[model samples]
Target: MESFLETFRNLDTSQKILYVFGGAAVTAVSLVAIRILTLKEEKRKDYPRDKVILHQIGRGPFAPSMTPFAVKLETYLRMARIPYQSQGASFNIFLWTIRRHNKKQTWNQGHGRHTEEEIVEMMNKDIQSLSDFVGRKRFLMGDEPSEADCSVFGMLSQTYWQFYGSGYENLIKDRYPNLASYCERMKDAFWPDWDQCITHGGTREATK
Candidate 1:
């Protein structure tokens, strides 16, 4: 320990600083390389690109208000035979986190009010916007499931399926029958195990 200390002390301040920086850089590079290598190996073992189009659906576990978007998107994807995955959670958590971190803001700033009612309203508006975009077309962008469909479905499914009894269900199911039907058909077609996907505790079941 004494020899190590002596050796370290022998170096000038700039050299010592450079040495620390270099060591940090090397460690960072090594960590990054390890992560890349690990990810590549995992990808090779778990999710091969040749198998399916790796798409993920995202939503919150509690906010059922996002259903319209999810259902519509799922319909388009199923019709177009686009393979994807669903990630259910609070719809805005990931995006809100990104916004907060990237712009150096708080969660409240990144998102609006934190009440369930507010969340439900936001989701309703978003879905309505998506529906308007879909118009009379059988799908979101014309008769085909575009890349946009995948994203829209992921968000919507979480809201509709997960937030069934959480006060948002009435807002959605009461007003959007087409959207409700769309969700039913999508679930029946794509996710036969719909009950299992219920991240929130089972309560208000999705009506067909």
Candidate 2:
């Protein structure tokens, strides 16, 4: 009998798409079966009591999840004071498997056809522009804080505080001292207990 790969190679274009989809469906069902079979009631003890198990795309240690939906859902869970734990699938593996060999197509769809270096350059330029706009001012609009400062500071704080070891932290700290100062100024003014609020594990403590 011909091997599966040999049979697949002989398929026409429409047949190939169907074949791939069928294989993927089988694999997904198998994974789900395995998970269900392995996770006996006895295994429940390993998980937190009464906590929700959230399944979503995995994220790198320093970056937010690539899926805005996951981020929004997680944020809602946190804000609602719901107890939950995330079980993430490997994002790169997910993309690879789902996109098959179409990496260029995936990249174009996801990142607007920009190379990694190009994306970083664009981000740095935007930050530099903001740095120049802030210049010697205490805030983005002027010396006094404005609504714009609130929005800008929220985004900047994510880079300054959460994205550790990523060059973005250094980008703001080293190249844009004014922006760094601006973040600090906003933090001091609004989040007065900022340092104390940070836990030993580097996460900020939850507040009302």
- Leading candidate by lDDT: 2
Q: How far is 121's C-alpha from truth in model 2 (Å)?
A: 0.5
Tens digit of lDDT per residue, candidate 1, span 1-208? 2222233345343222222212233223333444444555546655535434322223223332223444445555455767664423322332332322322222224332244355445556777876666656654666544666555555556445543334454544676665666555445656564554443442443332
Task: List runs of model 2 lying over 4 Å from the truth.
Answer: 1-112, 202-208
True-structure Cα RMSD, model 1: 16.9
Which pairs clash (backbone N, Cα, C closer than 3 Å) in model 2?
A: none
Model 2: worst 10 consecutive residues (lDDT sum): 14-23
- TM-scores for candidates 1 onward, in order: 0.43, 0.46
- Model 1, residue 95: distance off in Å is 17
lDDT of each: 0.43, 0.51
- True-vs-predicted CA distance for residue 26, candidate 1, Å: 30
